[model samples]
Target: MESVFEAFLSFYLNPGFFYGTVLVVLLILFISIFYRLFPNSGFSILFDYFFEKMYDFFEDILGNEEKKWIKTYVVILFFVILISNLLGVFLEILVPVFGNIADTDVSLLKKYIDIPTADINFNIAMALIGLLIIIFEQFRALGFGKALYEYFPIFGKNYLPYTRGNLNPIFDWPLFILVKIFDLIISLFLGLLEIVGHFAKVISLSFRLFGNVTSGGMLLAMLVGAISGLTLTYLNFEFPVLGPVILYFQSLLVALIQALVFPLLIAIFIKVAKFA
Candidate 1:
């Protein structure tokens, strides 16, 4: 367990993780201080407004029954993705200073100061966790037996043989055999398809988040590189002012959208599972 914990920490050695962690900590501290210092301030008012909006957003989609437990999960998922998406923008401001302090080149720091959502491993893990929650919720709503049949409906009673009395070899044998064969084929096909669909959900969820964030990060990096090269080669300015401005606005919008979308989809999945 100790080794496993150490390995996890090693994964965040890059500047992205450093800045992301610091920003999250600082955000919590800021909120705490504001709440304590001025309970009736605009900061609290704005926060309450945002929280109510988010609560209503999920509550509308999940309905009242599920809104109780599932709201917590949705909130957690939204904030984590939101922070990760915003991390790239924060890195834009902090990377140069950190690079200089570490005596590392700017080029090296750029790669390290990436958005966490851009990391496929993080996206995949989050997707898998969402998938697992759906499965677990289904099992809780419907017992294990029913949940098993839900995923592989072929195993349900409807597909099984209805053996009422002793079979007649002459009259029922042929028809019974045909029905059994047909049932087996249909069940196998549907079961395999259902299994494949579950796997596909994981792939789709992970790739959707990963691809969007990664592409945005890459675009920002490319713009920064191009602008820096041109300015250094042709102009007198050392910093690329346009790149940062563009990245800030673009990343901010993308971050909010992706963060909202991910949790929204997860909530939908949970709803589907509950109804299924």
Candidate 2:
């Protein structure tokens, strides 16, 4: 019991652990304070305008879908992803600033700031779930038989369409049987191809999102490391945050682009699945 308590205490009160929590609290306080101090401030207007533009942008990309909630969903997804990416910006500075402050070995970054988008597994899981939702939508819109046909299209026009072309009133039995066998093989092959294609789409989409996010984070880390001694120094009585902070601002565009793109692709896929 004592060992467990000790472990919990160590984890809870670890060095540099509260920095991120404190910063998050401060940020929330700042925003609330702004709203309180100036109810009609330009900052509030600018923020509202930005959100309105984001809503319109997503709505345009999503088109006039019946599920209007999906547009709201995409907007929410964009915000979640953008916030996650932006939160990871300070990782390069977080550890450096506090690593030496504590006599213990643990660092600030170790305790705080996990960018979920950078994880391929997280992205892949999201892709899988999103694909599942699309499939469900297709089923709901097109009924069972047709939805299955959309994927397999086993009686595909070019492949088989039907073996009846070889089996006519003349009753060429052997030729008909041969054609049926051949088409069975073709249908099996095409079905497998379709399955593989679905899996490939999930992998490709997940990897693309993962690569973009991780690359941005690594670029900032590399730039910070390059000048950690010259300017971004803990010993130089500096905050060690400027380089990372600038890189953070620079990354905002990519964050927005990625947030917009990921959902747009999913929406496009859903639309195609519904109509195709």
| Number of the predicted model whose TM-score against the real structure is largest | 1
User: Which one wins on lDDT?
Assistant: 1
Stretches of model 1 off by over 4 angstroms after superposition = 1-19, 22-26, 29-33, 93-115, 154-176, 228-243
Model 1: ten consecutive residues of lowest lDDT: 98-107
**Candidate 2 lDDT tens digits, 143-217:** 999877755765543454335555564776666656677876776677677668678879877898889987876
Per-residue lDDT of 22 in model 2: 49
Clashing pairs in 2: none
| Residue pair clashes in candidate 1 | none
What's the lDDT for candidate 1?
0.74
**Per-candidate TM-score against the hidden true structure:** 0.75, 0.68
Please list the C-alpha lDDT of all candidates, in the order they appear: 0.74, 0.67
What is the TM-score (0 to 1) of candidate 1?
A: 0.75
Q: What's model 2's lDDT at 20? A: 37
